[model samples]
Target: MLSPVSTDSNHHPLNGTDATEHSVGADLPRAIATLNEEETYRALLTATHWATLDHAYGSAAEAPKRLAELLAQDQTVRTKALDYLHYTLHHQNTLYEATAPAALYVAAILPNPRTTRTVDKGHNSFPGCMRAELLLWIASVADAVTDEADVLSRRHGFPLDDYPPAVSIRRIRPQLYSAAVAYVDDTDRPTAEAAITACIRLLDDPRLLHHRAALVPGIRQILGTSEQWQHRERAIDALDTWGEDSTGLEGQQNPFLFCDSDTPTDNGSRPIDTNEGYSEPPPF
Candidate 1:
């Protein structure tokens, strides 16, 4: 069930800055802080808005509902919400107009500290892996929207005026990238690893390249301290691929070579290739 859109003016605060010029780390939270969840949901999920948007299965009216489900208390419900998002918005590695809006909500939900905490005896109930999966989905949606916008620009010699949602996606990309970078040190291994993966995927965007200085320390920390070999390997790969200077680390002979060939690594199970359009296989 979708939450009712709040009509109160106080609930719909605006950050009062140009989205384009906003700084990364400070901008995402600021923009999110100003948003009214219900109002935003209402604006993005209406029939008039969704009538034009088409997902793999067709109409994307359910996107907002699924997005709302992400905030549900049950971990299973949250996981299903992510799965539905992947199936609909990003099915077959394809992006839809609804993808960007959905990505925004995903970014909004991620900053909550409870989302990344391990299940504990106290108030925290959501599983950390659910947050990790959401990070993967954010990266996938961001990558897909970027690819779509680039393709349109190359073909038309201008921005995507034909698709207004694509423009929104491009505009919000910096904030999305910032949110991912900010969460790189989340205490849970899965959440931190997924955050790193999102950062690596986002490097493909020129707007986020400037964030390299901000992202390096977290990547380095993950490479040096994370218990999961997958997290460490991905961080090392990101550093090497980006040519980031890892000189801050103490004496080490090619820290990049720390991972032996025999060590198994999980190449993030999600299928998020920009060039590939393969549909997900059946679970059987």
Candidate 2:
């Protein structure tokens, strides 16, 4: 589902000077290792923000190669690389690798939940702060989408700021569609239905108003169910925003037993399991 960003894969749109020089290349591994010490880690995090804002493309291009180099000598460096790569992806929207031939393969090599470990430092640390901010952004956007484009914009329910800006919502729209389709097919009807319901909620996110074409078709799946009441209301709100159907009744009981409110209301319901586009308990 990830689309090619630019027609020209042979050329980079913009280039920056590579400041980190490895003269011998042979001594690069040892040098990078030495650079990863505590002070360097803090510097890296500080550098991350500036790189994200000003030089995202360069950082995204550089992080993976540096990661592979560091991973070869000491696996722990993978942690640092992953953190930086995540930052690049969230900010720059650059591909994992610059070359067309290596894009898919490199992307697949990304560590998922299985391989990637969360970097936590007590209650407050740079990475920790980043994670919290990223989560908040995701929650905000997810609560704002209005249709398929919004869902696409939100990157299949993942928050926009948590990933590199180089990877656009449009690029991954097909994957999001496939994921939703798969969610509907799973044997557990209620769970599958609930996920579809969540998709409706995602589209209702206010941030996605401009992308109505991508969101309207999925509305039929979310209509008239107490189970998905809140999502239904949001969907209705989105529909209203688009001048489709914007009316709401007070004290309506949602079939899914969800609370009715524009703001997020966590009722402590069962967790949604959305892997492989099917219904199953989360891998808790």
Candidate 3:
């Protein structure tokens, strides 16, 4: 099989969760007021023919079921199903035919906190709600369609277009950006950071350029403190691209700050980490 262009290597996570740490990020319920979470999820699911979509593997027919499991009453089921979706939707940052719609589903379900039971799902040591990880995955998908990535994909004979199992995921930038921007003010810092990263790349849609400045403050915030270098780096690039001054911002906080060994750390006392670097997982 021919390898296509890997546009953005900016954001990602994994398929497994460390059993020891289970930290939750900001309260999602507060972000969403009075919305019927269950009804909303069902409505979104009913409109899509998931069986006709495609992922890194095969048909996305199983996607709807896996996504519905996000609301499962069982913790193990929720986390495991989340992991499965991540693995299938974005294997190694190579977006598949099914990636876009699946991503839309993830974005659609953001308002519900009942689906957030996993932690340490991102490549960073950041402890957050499962929503944060989902946002980060969106970022990774958008990252795969950046200008540089497009050049590489073309050179590699993949062309990053709305074609087969190769590059169809590149054309839906505007829609994805629209869905992701809804959480830019999320109470969860990681989630907000992930959403910001996603919106920055998806802004490739010329129509969204005017909104770039609005996202600056969040980008600055990410650069100021995020443990994930990939997120921080993207923020810096975005600032430069948009002509925003990113003066004193650094690439990463001291991962060693108040830590022992090289294992890295998480939200204050938690010490939660996936031990993965900036690259990704089978689902990046």
Candidate 4:
């Protein structure tokens, strides 16, 4: 396992327990604040860093602004943010120094209720579907990192040091994991499905797969219910993939094996929309 990166005295590592006990959304501001102070993060924010870092559009100068705009209240703004992220950070499955932090920011914002609210009263807003898309993008980036790392290790004939971007992600795995779990239970079907997809893709990383026991129950819950047909199918697909590689889980009542793809309802009825008590994102 990689050693935890050292942070200042005021900043604490976001372990699984802290994530469980506290709201991941509530903790995002502090996490971003702490990240801002890290040397590598600070470098990524600089104009010089953007000028030197290559992206699909030649330079990554817009990366920092786009990262900040991901928190914007406007649906258009957030969509643009996703576009910029997709075009630059991991364009064509290429990772950069900024890719990891970009992914971290994506994970940090996932559970923020402010980012998940649908548009209302003509105010610009983020939709649950968009948030779900962002989660999918996050999953893609994580999978790309694993693929790239493996290729490099094989070619170099030695285990490479943790890629800088991945190291940044490792520093906050607990927070990401916590947010993902919270998202899986989100009232919006697409958002929840997206979260499940993210969780499944993240399992591609060996470190995360090693901790699969903690996440398996949640995966089972999704697969065993009628939350959303598409979500359930995605969950089943992810579990099936993981089951193939996971020898330990063999003969342990694989949830995917018994899942009914054609039937939307399982032992329980379809989940009711329970948006009550949830606040909409405040207008900009």
**Of the candidates shown, which would achieve the greatest lDDT relative to the real structure?**
3
Cα lDDT computed for each candidate against the true fold: 0.57, 0.32, 0.58, 0.50
Residue pairs of candidate 1 with colliding backbone atoms:
none
The reply for model 3, stretches above 4 Å from the true place, is 1-40, 120-127, 162-171, 252-284
For model 2, how does the per-residue alpha-carbon lDDT over 1-284 read when each residue is reduced to its tens digit? 11111111221111221323212111122223344354532333233222333233443335435434322333345444433433333222233323211221122222122222233222222222222222222222223333443457576666434443223232322222223333333344333333344344333434433444544544444333325454456556546666774444222454566433222233112221234421222223
Choose 2 or 4, whichever is better by TM-score.
Answer: 4
TM-score of 2: 0.30
The TM-scores of all predictions, comma-separated, are 0.62, 0.30, 0.70, 0.56
State which candidate has the highest TM-score. 3
Per-residue accuracy of model 3 over 42-142 as CA lDDT, tens digit each: 64555555677777667888887888887677766776666665556766555676776566567557666674566544344343577766666667677
Ranking by lDDT: 3, 1, 4, 2
Q: Model 1 off-target regions past 4 Å?
A: 1-29, 34-48, 113-128, 145-169, 223-230, 245-284
The per-residue C-alpha lDDT of model 2 at residue 237 equals 54
| Alpha-carbon shift of residue 272 in model 4 (angstroms) | 31
